[model samples]
Target chain A: AQTVTQSQPEMSVQEAETVTLSCTYDTSESDYYLFWYKQPPSRQMILVIRQEAYKQQNATENRFSVNFQKAAKSFSLKISDSQLGDAAMYFCAYRSPLRDDKIIFGKGTRLHILP
Target chain B: GAGVSQSPSNKVTEKGKDVELRCDPISGHTALYWYRQRLGQGLEFLIYFQGNSAPDKSGLPSDRFSAERTGESVSTLTIQRTQQEDSAVYLCASSSSQGSANSPLHFGNGTRLTVT
Candidate 1:
């Protein structure tokens, strides 16, 4: 079984600043996928960024990037130039490369953007 | 629809009653998933269906919860003798292909179920 952990329950960042949300997972599989999902008050899950375990280079999507340390079993999400729209509940997820492709999610961290 | 669609955006039912939640995945998507989200918590995988493959119900919390997907289209999650703890938001998602690490999931707004 794979378990994702987000130590921070809540986080706040000032507008236009940068913020990093930590995530760690325990998985025995050598090949897998890591993802960060954002859910606003609307309760819609949106993909933020994703990282492949086999890739040494981190994944970057515009202002959202990920720091993936496979050896340490750590995958963190970084949001640069944070805006009010970035305020949401962020979740770290783990998915197997196998056929099942079921995602296991962390408890989540509520992000707040301050003006 | 252009995206994943879940029916009955909100449902209220009495405890011990059976409820069914529907999900309409994006057209041409081969993978569909069901997840449960409790208040202020992350999503928990409930079931998954990949094309014609047998569905994975390993994540289901109890035998009372069951789900079925017809081919690559609509899916329904049924909870029998629902309990108060079953109250939560049920989310449905679909992906373009199976076992594609780069494919991101498209999610629906989710059905908020309240069992009183």
Candidate 2:
């Protein structure tokens, strides 16, 4: 069984500043994928970024990027130049690289961007 | 539909009653999944169907909850004799990853199920 943990329940960032949401997971498999999803007030789950365990080079999607440390079993999301619209509930998810692919999501972190 | 669309955007049902939630996955998508999100909680995996085969049904909380997909298209999640604990948003997702397992899931807005 794979378990994803997001230690921070809530975090706040000033406008134009950066925020990093931390996530860790426990999995015995050697190959897997990590992801960050955002859910806004509308309650639509949107994919933020993704990182494959085999890729040491972190994944970056404009303002959203991930710091994936496979050895440490940690995958963190960094949002740069945060804006008010960036405020949402962020979730870290884990997916197996095998045939039966299932995604496991963490408890989630509520991010608040202050103007 | 253009994206994964779930019907009955909001369902208010009494405890012990049965409810059926529907999901229409995107065209050409071979994978469909059901997830539950309780208030103030993360998404919980319920069931998964890939190209007419459901290889994983382990995430379902209890036997009362079951789901089915036909011909790799529409899916329905049925909860029999629903309980208060079953109140939550039922989310449906679709992906193109059939057996190879690399595509990411695209989620719908979700059906909010309120069991009182």
Candidate 3:
């Protein structure tokens, strides 16, 4: 079984500043996919960024990026130049490389942005 | 993308009653999934369907919870004898394909279910 853990229950960042959300997972599978999802007040789950275990290079999507350390089993999300709209519940999820494998998610971290 | 859509945005039912939640996957999507999110928490995987094949129900908390998919299009999660603990937001998501390492899931607004 794979388990994802987000040590921080809540986080806050000043507008235009950067914030990093930590995430760690325990998985025996060598091949897998990692993802970060954001759920706003509207409650719609939106994809933030994703990382492939096999890729040594980190994944970056504009202001959003991931620091994936496969050996350490760590995948953390970094939000650069944070804005008020970035305030939401962020979750780290894992999906097995195997076909039909279900996605497992960690307890989310509530983000707050200060103006 | 059309994105995944769910019906009955909100549902309230009494204990011991059976409730069904619907999920409509995006056109041409081959994978659908059901998840449960308790208030102020992360998502809990409930079930996964690949086309018309057998679904993976490993995440269902109990036998009272079951789901079905029709021709890889619409899927429904049925919970029998609903309990107070069952009250949560039921989310639906779909992906272009399953068993792939790179596919990212697209989620719907979710159905808020309350069991009284």
* Candidate 1 stretches greater than 4 Å from native: none
**Each predicted complex: what DockQ?**
0.72, 0.67, 0.82
Judging by TM-score, tell me the better candidate of 2 and 3: 2
Query: RMSD of each candidate?
Result: 1.5, 1.4, 1.5
Model 1 chain A weakest lDDT span, ten residues long: A95-104
Candidate with best TM-score: 2
Candidate 1, residues A42-79, lDDT tens digits: the string is: 99999998898999999999999999999999999999
Q: Model 1 over residues B24-116: C-alpha lDDT tens digits?
A: 999999888999999998888888888745456778899999888787799999999999999999999999884575688999999999999
Deviating ranges (above 4 Å) for candidate 3: none
Worst 10 residues of 2 chain A by lDDT: A95-104
Q: Chain B, candidate 3: TM?
A: 0.93
Across all candidates, the chain A TM-score values are: 0.97, 0.96, 0.97
Clashing pairs in 1: none
Identify the candidate with maximal DockQ.
3
Q: What is candidate 3's CA lDDT for residue A1?
A: 82
Of 1 and 3, the candidate ahead on TM-score is 3
